[model samples]
Target: MINLGEKKLILASQSPRRKELLKGLGFDFEVRSKDTSEDFPINLDPSEVAGFLSAKKAAAFAHEIVPNEIVLTSDTVVILEGKILGKPANEEEAFEMLFALSGKTHLVTTGITFLTLEKELTLSDTAKVFFKELSGQEIEYYISNFKPFDKAGGYGIQEWIGFVGVEKIEGSYFTVMGLPIHLVYDVLKNL
Candidate 1:
């Protein structure tokens, strides 16, 4: 178990998966979702893109942090064919993203920001995920049934599609779930 010492932990996001993953670390924390527009410049690398977004989210909660509080923010994205696939806007887009990812390996990068009154730190973790060739029917069925509008790359590793389609994964599985628990725990411990 990771102890955060006397720092009051606060998570600044609305992702239930992140919340659950953080809770699995056995640390006490609070969830406060902040509304921040996610817009990044085109020239940034994939990891930089995620880190920038995470820092943006953390900065959005600047007014909420106190002296004894540490706020966490994170962003995850799937990069395939050198393009970043964020959350799909609808079912058709979701199917399209899945189709593009079929029979290919993609990179899943999650950036995390830890902010406190004393210091602010931002870091990123990347995972490689391989998918077997997915049929159009399979993509359609998964998108129609699961409605993965909230997941990057239009899929979740813990979802039905992952069980049926994902072939292999390299690096931390929790990063693909939208939070890198191992990295987060390490950062918090040092803090």
Candidate 2:
């Protein structure tokens, strides 16, 4: 168990996966989604891009933070071949990303920002996921059934495709899911 010193928790995201992950840690929090453009310069690395976006989202609420409220924001991205693959625009793009990731290892990065009236902390977690070779049919089937337009990398590690395709993972599974619960717990404990 941990104690947060009178800080009201606020999660600034609309992702159900992130909400669910945070709930699993047994913290009481409120959800407040913000509208922020997620654009970044093309030259930023994958992890840096995620961190920047996460902080950007937090900064969007800088003037709204109450004295006793802490806001949390996060961004996750998929990186392959040194290129960042954000959420797919359509099924065709989803298929392309999944196909490109088939039988390969890729990095999943989740950047988290904790903001309060007097302090801010931004951290990122990276996971290496290895997938077995996926057939074209399997890729199409997964996309058709899962419709992962909101998920980075066009797949969910907690879903059917992960059960069938993911061969190994080298870091926090929850990071691939969108939030790093362990890191969040630790950070909150110290906040």
Candidate 3:
């Protein structure tokens, strides 16, 4: 367990995955987040957009942060070729995303930011996830059952699809899950 000497840890994210990951670290924190736009500049490199949004989320809590409170924010993005794939809006979009990702390798990037009343630190971790070629029936079944509308790239690494389809991963698995827990632990342990 990591201890933050007399500091109150505040997690400013709505992602249950992130919440669970943080809890696994054995740190006590409160979840506090406001709805914020996921929009990013079209010109941003897929590698950079996640970090941008992570810091943007942190800004929402800046005004209310106390001296001993450390706010954590994170954002995850899926990049295919060079474009960012956001969470799908519906089944059709979800199907398209999975189909495109079928039999291919893509980047899963997660940006994490630690903000205090005094300063801010933002960092990103990227992972390469390789999927087996998904058949139409497979995609349809997964979408109908899993309803990946809340996940980036229209899929979750901890779900059924990932269990059967993910053949390899090149980086931290926690990063693909939308929070890099090892990085989170290292950051807090050093703080």
Please give the lDDT score for candidate 1.
0.91
Tens digit of per-residue lDDT, candidate 2, span 53-141: 99999999999898989899999999998899888999999999999999999999999999998999999999999999999999999
Give per-residue CA lDDT, model 3, range 1-191, as digits (tens).
Answer: 66787999999987889999999888999999899899999988889999999999998888899999999999999999988999999999999999999999999999999999889999999999999999999999999999999999999999999998999999999999999998889888888
- Which residue pairs come into collision in candidate 2? none
Provide the overall lDDT of each model, using Cα atoms, as 2-decimal numbers: 0.91, 0.92, 0.94
Kindly list the per-residue Cα lDDT of model 1 for residues 29-95, writing each as its tens digit.
9998878988899899776888999999999978768998999999998999789999999988998
Position 84, candidate 2: lDDT:
93
Worst 10 residues of 1 by lDDT: 1-10
Q: Cα deviation in Å at residue 103, candidate 3?
A: 0.5
User: Which 10 successive residues of model 3 have the least lDDT summed?
Assistant: 1-10
lDDT-wise, the better of 1 and 2 is 2
Q: How many residue pairs clash (N, CA or C atoms closer than 3 angstroms) in each of the candidate models, in the order given? A: 0, 0, 0
Q: What TM-score fits each model?
A: 0.97, 0.98, 0.98
Best by TM-score: 3
